[model samples]
Target chain A: MTHGTTSPHPAEPAPAPRRGRPRDAARDRALLDATLAVLAENGYGGLTTAAVAARAGVSTATLYRRWSSKEELVIAAAALHGESSYEQPGTGTLEGDLRVVLREKAAAMTGEPGRLIRALIGEAAHNTALAEALVTAFLQPLYDRVAEVVRRAVERGEIPPLDGVELLGEVVVGPVMTHFLLTPRLPEDVDQATARETADRLLPFALRAVGGTP
Target chain B: MTHGTTSPHPAEPAPAPRRGRPRDAARDRALLDATLAVLAENGYGGLTTAAVAARAGVSTATLYRRWSSKEELVIAAAALHGESSYEQPGTGTLEGDLRVVLREKAAAMTGEPGRLIRALIGEAAHNTALAEALVTAFLQPLYDRVAEVVRRAVERGEIPPLDGVELLGEVVVGPVMTHFLLTPRLPEDVDQATARETADRLLPFALRAVGGTP
Candidate 1:
């Protein structure tokens, strides 16, 4: 069926009234929520558009109209989920800014975002398309935000203009990522307290690695 | 059909003549190799003991005699593959020792071990057993080795006795792991030159994080 049914104005509609803008936005949210649920349950290998559609209480046709494939759907959902996870913090010092960033990351790691991160890492090894999408949609933005934080630090004279400042993202988050994602601990075992502790412990090293006095 | 066929002393008048010790060792090696091959091709989710047995040119029954389950088989195979990947280096200085370790790790990341590592990580997100196996069989030993390197450095008064020296393993390897595994680069693109470059770039940071003078 056409998308004209949810038009805002039927009688005085101007070419189908933007074709269900509001309703489609709500449906897209539902579909993305369903996608995450299915991904958490079934993982990237097992996730199917049909399963996501069914979970969302929509027909596969409706789901396909928005996202052409499961990869597209997952990428969209992950991007949405991770969009607010990293914020460019201006805490006036490199250490202060990174502490805020790491705390937020630690908090995020104790929840669904953490689980999704693990699953994405697991699948990205084999799936090049998903890997590229994850980099473009999630990691690139995170790196850019971190670069912004470093740039602010440099401007403040908190740290000198380093040679390899771009490597700061990996240096800052790598240990924390290894702790939560690569460690043997199960997701349930990774609570907020331990996550925060790990973040606190690694922050000094991160600062040192970033060429700051910790 | 019995393991008695390959007995070294068929007529030794002992019960089953130790059950084909030499031949069984060889067979076990073949089975483990086959398990890694299947794991690389099918991943942890798609691996089957039947497929491993077929690849090894042995019966499933024969495979089961050594490892009872696919998890056991995979763990054994992974342990064997990763066993030689780490060694305790006594390069006198922490930097020299860590340099060797990181270079070896970078080299290992470009080959089959790297691929298997990525696959295991992907499956380990959802599979607690595999995750535990990886930690106990792979990560713990690697950590122990790094700890040894740090301990030697401490003994030589290279760095003061750090409180959280155990975290050195994660610190030393985290950025490298993030660069190779978590980034968008495909496995084929992670060649020795780039891997070495990443390891070299992160080396000074690692030393600094470990409280050593870079």
Candidate 2:
């Protein structure tokens, strides 16, 4: 009952070991790497900051310092996560360019991307800020790359005009994505034969939709 | 709750109100209606059985009576929701039959169906059971319907056969669904012009994908 006597064991022993908030670029990279690791191991909902920090051997504050929320962190991690870097060949033909571009990202096509992409999209559906960030950061770049190929096709007169670029975008990615989003069972790798078949089949519809070919 | 307090709930003064038991037809219909209302108001994630019960003027027990989990109930509500009633005219041609059927449904489409349809698909993304139930109950039916139409088209020598029936299903719904899922602004109507245009534009590709036009 001695009011003045402080406990021998102070609250949070060692004052939680303050590190003075120095920017750890190495820790940040590790955290991002760990985020992808956790994402691949578990889905978007299952991935946690604690797990990422633990995996990266960094304090949780280090993570919070870089990312405002889990969603932002996940998107950033996704951007740097894997073989997202693509090389679309400047083939003389439209189909040639598509085949090259798609085939480049083909092997790196893991199941994780599809699920995370859908989850990110679903999250964006409800969040305006996230949606804008997502479009500007993740989706826009992908769209721009695809649109460039399509534009090249127009220049080569291999396909139609730009009337249905959005629709054309959908036609190219719609089945793959819809299948990915709704059904995760399909294999992601599109081999040459399959890619050629798909191009032959889909390019026609896209052509007509964009007021070309037919 | 307080050491076996006597049951003095005014809501259940006499016979205990049935909440966890099997719900009858009338109760089931009411719950489904309430579910649609809740879904319309609160969206997929915000929708709860409590809201459904409150909206239906039924006890929580009664709400849980027919459905074991909220996921199941939502799926059940959406599963039994569609009207498959149709007058398929044997107009001596596959195109005629498809055009007639789709045109009619398009003509009769309302905002209610569209919203619920979007909500159901949206919810399915997050909830596994909802996803299975939706594909099983809602999407499967649509798939089967379109499959039958394609099968008839083959029989009538309208198109060449393709391997992916599900792919065919996607073609039927994909373009419109693209707008539905991606665009925030919904048109006032499904719009007869849009429907006709979509059906016509997608027809040649659909025919080619299914089988070369018979």
Model 1, stretches more than 4 Å misplaced?
Answer: A1-20, B1-20
lDDT of 2 by residue, B20-74 (tens): 3333545667887898878777888788888999999999987775677887777
lDDT of 1 by residue, B82-145 (tens): 6667567877889998888888777666666788888787778778888888887777777787
Interface RMSD of each: 1.2, 4.1
TM-score of chain B of each: 0.86, 0.72
Worst 10 residues of 1 chain A by lDDT: A1-10
* TM-score per candidate for chain A alone: 0.86, 0.66
lDDT of 1 by residue, A1-214 (tens): 1122332332342343355454666677789899998887877878999999999999999898888877778988876777677567877888888888887777666666887877887778778888887887777776777778888888888777766667877777777778788766665567788878878888888887767887
Chain A agreement with the truth for model 1, given as TM-score: 0.86
**Best by the TM-score measure:** 1
* Tens digits of per-residue lDDT for model 2, A1-214: 1110211122223322235333344555678789988976776658889999899998888788778788777767766543343444577766565555444333223244545555566655555565566565554565566788878877777764554455444444444445445542323333445544543454443333333432
Where does candidate 1 chain B have its weakest 10-residue lDDT segment? B1-10
TM-score of chain B of 2: 0.72
